[model samples]
Target chain A: MTNRILYVLALSAGLAVGPAAAETPVTIGMITTLSTKAGYLGEDIRDGFQLAIDQGGGKLGGVPVELVVDDDGRKPEKGKQIAERFIKHDKVKILTGIVFSNVAMAVVPKVVREGVFYISPNAGPSRLAGKGCDENYFNVAWQNDNLHEVVGQYVNDKGFKNVYLLAPNYPAGKDALAGFKRFYKGKIAGEVYTKLGQSDYAAELATLRAAKPDAVFFFLPGGMGINFLKQYAQAGLNETIPVFGPAFSFDERLLKAVGGAAVGVRNGSQWSHDLDNPANKAFVDAFRKVYDRTPTLYASQGYDAAHLIGSALAATGGSLSDMDAFRAALERADFDSVRGKFRFGPNHHPIQDLYIREVIETPEGTITNRIEAKVFTDHADAYASECQM
Target chain B: MLLILEQLMNGLQLGVMLFLMSAGLTLVFGIMQVINLAHGSFYMVGAYTAATVTQLTGSFLLGLLAALPAAAAVGMLVEAVVLRRLYSRDHLDQVLATFGLILFFNELTRMIWGRQPLFMDVPDWLSGTVELFPGAPYPSYRLAVIGMGILVAVFLYLLFTRTRLGMQIRAGASNREMIAALGVNIRFLYTLVFGLGAMLAGLAGVMAGPILAVEAGMGEEILILTFVVIVIGGIGSIRGALIAALLVGMVDTLGRVFLPGLFRLFLPVAEADGIGASLASMSVYILMAAILVWRPRGLFPAQI
Candidate 1:
């Protein structure tokens, strides 16, 4: 009787210890804007990230992971509070997924200082890419200015003599205009910074008409872009002036909302659904099958962020105790990115090919981006020189 | 000179839209003495309903027709169910209850429509531009909006001056208890007034649908402007709302257009642009404050 009782105790002890020793899932906290007007952006990022983990059978690169997601509602203060909870209560060692640059500025600097690893899926603010660059912070996305710089070069190549610029009055908006001016050697007819969430652009459009630039470049993302494009078309200015912008305004979902107004406009992006790559094809197909909608560039970044972290977890054997090994592994970035030819510059921002995409309506009447030309090959951010790291 | 004329037209167009929104809001506050923060939710409801209906039927007219009744029904239902009990409550209680309604309506739209904004194109008939003058071409759709605002204003004037229901509404705004004592079905009258106010907001929403992105929480932006219009024009007076809406619209539109240019004459371009943009956004609020100092009870306060 004594021998049998001891046997039962040993078996129960083995059952408890066996799984815990073999697989202790790493917890990753994701803070992104999932409410308000920009909620769809964060939804796509979350869906794409979750898709990668789902494909791995609740693991990434054979290492188990648990993703805890929260919405920031596009507020900097709310983002800080969520980050605090994730760090203190959840004991999350790694964090990712912030959609807005302002929220990232509030959260990333503080968390990275406390020794938590941050892999940004989107929102590569210039400040973080330059003098504020940190070793613990890894952006799996291009610098905020990279895509805008491509359009500037394209506009210059097209021989536009005068360009009118418009963007919201915010940090990212300033970065967009600055990036465009860096490559376009043309006369700036007007540089206007409108209210961030202003719905009516009638006043600005009237002023833009008066300036009479050869071309117009704007960086209004999400609903702001939709409002601008629709109103621009209605005002009958679209027929006379060619419109240009970055990929944020031309995403698949936003294109659907803007409809015919977005067609024929050219925008710059780092990745597209039509990119010729095995990894990209698979990711796009799988994303469509799962989400029932075409994935945006934001989704691609989220997928890449997950795969990058997975590769690092695999390299370090799922052990986060040695921060140095994990950091080195992340720096190596031995993952097949959907963008193709992805690498990190010294500032931990993407150095990859950027393409010019024209918004085209497919034969089926769905509007999407078609890659027209590659503007830059193996390009690094202009701010890399400013980074000491 | 052409640019100045076009800017004025833009100001006039924005003014009429604000009038549509504020007329209903002022009437509700004036007659019911209940603060409805969820007034914007009705505007959102109208936009969403119109967008969806237009997409399904391929008719902008039908969409506009459907939105009016839908918004009125919802407003009446809310007034009957949630707001009916709050009539005798303090202003703070009314404010709190209506604020909760805003969140509820926002989430409800998100659930029904999802996060993606619905697209509503300008009808082909109204999509063209008109030569307002020799050099200035303005969108015909904007002109239609201005005309619609004028039509509604005339309709309201005729109703208030010629109709018995309008007389009761004016009387009720001044003395609710007296109307009740005079055998007016006060509850039913309040509901009808609320519905009428909601219909005007719906008209504003339908007009804005093609011009703005029709998404959840779209009403909150215009709601703030509507409040300013009502406060500047005396809170329960339709005449006051019209004048105040136009004034606010002119100040806001002209300020946005010429402020930076005004500053450029004296200051460096970049610094001037920054300051001008900031001040332009504040122009309407400044006007409101200036008006209040001159008339503590608003420009056309309802006679007690």
Candidate 2:
């Protein structure tokens, strides 16, 4: 009796998943780092997608959609497995939300090989924005370099004579460093490549103290950033030197731990909570009401990805067979993006603006990211031209 | 000199916290003769519990108090159901089983907590900064962590030295056969020791949550360092785990701070910085490697 009841419960829950159009059912395969260190960002991305779908009244272009969430555990191998599952078993028409760049790198090729549309809401590795870009791979997020360029320009604009570069020792880390150096025309006193996912920052900070650079530019996200910021504050350099990075380096989730120490540090962002756009304002208000917290840039990308998918689905009249049609539909970028005026390039990455924001103290919570300056106005990513597709 | 002193203190503080983790891990491994790779999972569980309770109840003391028993109970349950069957198994089998436990616990956390990281707020009483030296204000929470570790260490020392159960545990460590012959309930004792070890790990976890985000698989991230601490201190030695953990923490903290400057003096600025950064990151692993080369049995072997 218990077994039958449990089985019935499971089946009923499974039946409850789709949005309600009752057209040809299409599955969206999403592989994200939902079970590991970067799970917080993954959850935000998931929430953004789900919330968009829920608020869209469960139908994308009069077609019911099913989403299959697979936890990649931030592993390339796991991501590949999910990609195969999506392609083979589920016949997923769209693949999305591989949060980590490495995981995206692992999964995107499968989506392309299978001729399914993969919209990367996050993990915009520079390679994809350039020669490696696939026609069907629409990125709702900016390339790794584009966001870094915002901070790079800000650092240059501030007229800092010298700066230190900090990032993890990985492909993404190297790319971020190169991206920062691409625009920040300053004498680099030091460039420290930390161990990937390194939990301690004392030694790196020691080198920084000795170098005494005008500022520190870091690209650590998730727990590594949290650890680095904590030790950096603990090392007593919070007051001495300024720090800056991409918006992912500090957000509502992170500010809660680093606290006042994370304050006074400036970072470049694609969207601040206080962005001046009606679409963005609506997103922020609606997101705040539902989640009871400010959505990070990751969430913003996710929201945009879902809306873009919905728009494309409507444009195609919910057709899955016409590959060119779906590709063209996604490229239109007609969705009301949380990040303003997002238009896709030939490489399928967004051409959008980036901002510089300061972490301010607010009465409601620790997050008070106010736009201190604007870096890119309708900026096209540097690598877009290389992407002939 | 001032910088040196400050960095050193930072190292000691980090090291002591690591000691708390290593102590629990080594205790379970040595006395129980069971390789509980899911030991860190207990810490993760404790921290998550503490964060949830504190968030719900708005009291750190109450949260902490709840965290201990909750973690202890989890530890006891794990021992009874999963670990009890594997006591007679080889280390390889034990590792595989416990490693499975780690994955299970991580997945369980995700399903329960919905994967959004919870930020634990520091209670007002412990949130104030204390001046460790003239003009140097350290956050009262971090100092509290140090104080907690010292207190736990003292308590552990007393428990092992003064109590009858401690004598039995020590006996169990030396000769399981002899202890079994002595008409003691080894099965019950194992469960109790596992629970105790779990409590220690949970204490470490709850304390750590206020600083770190209470998220899934945090245990796996720290598991590597905890392993390093165990290997350096010695397998099957609580004293060794404590000493080695603190040593590693200090070396790692101090190395990262000073290595680049030392390299900058010798090499070109960019070259020096890169090499120094990499070297500083690898310094702890290097220390571990060196220790292993010299003393395969570790700095303090538990016994013959």
Every candidate's CA RMSD:
4.2, 6.7
Candidate 2 regions exceeding 4 Å error are A1-22, A25-27, A61-66, A203-211, A231-236, A256-261, A288-293, A320-322, A366-368, B56-59, B121-144, B261-275
lDDT tens digits, residue span A136-197, model 1 = 99999889999999999999999999999999887788889999999999999999988888
Off by over 4 Å in 1: A1-21
Extract clashing residue pairs from model 1. Answer: none
What DockQ results do all the predictions give, each relative to the true complex? 0.84, 0.29
Expressed as tens digits, the lDDT of each residue in B176-256 for candidate 2 is 889999999998998898999889889989888776667777887678888899988888788898899888988888777
Each model's interface RMSD (Å)?
0.7, 3.4
TM-score per candidate: 0.96, 0.88
User: Model 2 chain A: which ten-residue window has the lowest total lDDT?
Assistant: A15-24
